[model samples]
Target: MEKPRTIPSVFTPQWLPLGSLVLLLVTLALALTGCAAEKKWQYLPATRGEERSIYVIAHGWHAGIALPAEELGDELGFVREYLRPGRYYEFGWGEAEFYQADKITPAIFLKAVFWKNPSVMHVFSMPAEPAQQFPGADMVELKLSATGVKHLKDSLRTSFKLDAAHRPHPLKGGAHGEYRFFTAQGYYLITHTCNTWTAKVLASGGVPMDTVFTLRSGGVMRQAKDARKEYLKLRPDRAEQEGMQ
Candidate 1:
């Protein structure tokens, strides 16, 4: 005689964790869809040639854009005061208090996600050779054409909410005074999170990214790496020129 084992019911206590995980994922998906439903301007492909290298850096829950200090345009003059000529500038935007917090607690994270709060741009000034700065961190190097560079700089320029003097004022030192926070436009939202911002910035820079559901650092970095690959395919010669090999 043979007996068949009955399947466990999903309502059982043992399945509660699995059910909860599915519910969480569904809720996040719905939230991302609702928040990203806003209209976005379609971008044309970047122009051929005149490529410049930029980086997408991942710091666990956060992501940032890193570029040559020379690309720091006049519009973001405030960011220059923190670094010298031979430096790399990395920018990230997020909820002011939560982003600057040295240690994140459950309560702080909950408030940042559930509440609407002012945003701040955190600029990290690293050595010109940023390769070693974030040694253990995930980084992707992407090339942007002239048109893409312009779009990227424009995004950076417009992120700051200038004071009455028409300039972003530095707020305070962040991350053990290694970086500085500056006043920025827009509010940090659960759906339009820091990772979302990173994806949007890359999209503006002619990276083929769908910013809608890019609400996590891993996804943002993954898209950036893919974009780099696509850019290289269009101009394999430039990869050699840039010493990316």
Candidate 2:
């Protein structure tokens, strides 16, 4: 019988297919690299004019003051009788309340005012809560002016004195210190307190630390869709860092 013919080995002609496989991988890698290098939007800092406009829009009257209920009644003729004392001790008046607080006194009444043109508008007082009991409240006024708000913002950028970041500290009478800035309608409000817990809440909520600051800072008479765009631009790098975390 004739000897069986021998078959060639599978590896004998491997380079042709191997070369094609390698080329495919290299092409794929280049495509992926191009995708990775795609362009992304860059954040631009707000210009002076833009900053001024933002300040104006954010400065409207949205102020609040906490005062003894009785004292509020004495000062404002009509107390916010509808409010429940313990349940709703918070108050909101005008933009002036955005910044200034002379001192902290328990049982003190807070009076807040707002004005686009101070002469044209009626000054408003903080409303009362039903559950609160201010037997012998004193009056405390929180004032905000355009110049003052700008000064406060500048102070924040330069010095840490304003407590705008909501840092916590202890006070003499078992109280905690905190502050916040907030805006509503076409107004801004600032609030200060020895109550540390309250401060944290306000700061986390992005509220103004002082109503006076809010009024001086300025704001748009009407809300804008891109109002928060600057704030986002302020920390563009944060998103990438957060994603890595």
How high is each candidate's TM-score?
Answer: 0.77, 0.17
Clashes of each: 0, 49
Off by over 4 Å in 1: 1-49, 83-86, 174-177, 238-244
RMSD of each: 12.0, 30.1
Residue 216 displacement in candidate 2 (angstroms): 16
Task: Give the per-residue lDDT of model 2 (tens digit) for 1-245.
Answer: 21221211110112334455546533543343211112221222333222211121111112122333333322222223322232222332222221323332221112221123100111122233321222222222222223332443332222111145433221111011112222222332122211111222222223233211112211111111122333334546633554588
Identify the leading candidate in terms of lDDT: 1
Q: What local lDDT score does residue 105 receive in model 1, on the 0 to 100 scale?
A: 55
Candidate 1 on 1-245: residue-level lDDT in tens?
Answer: 11211211110112234455546744784556323323332343444446577898887667789888778766565677654433678888988877766655556656776789889888876664556776667889876776777888889878888777777778877434446788888999877888788888888887777687888777787767766666556666656766754
lDDT of each: 0.69, 0.25
Give the worst 10-residue stretch by lDDT in candidate 2: 117-126
Model 1 earns a TM-score of 0.77
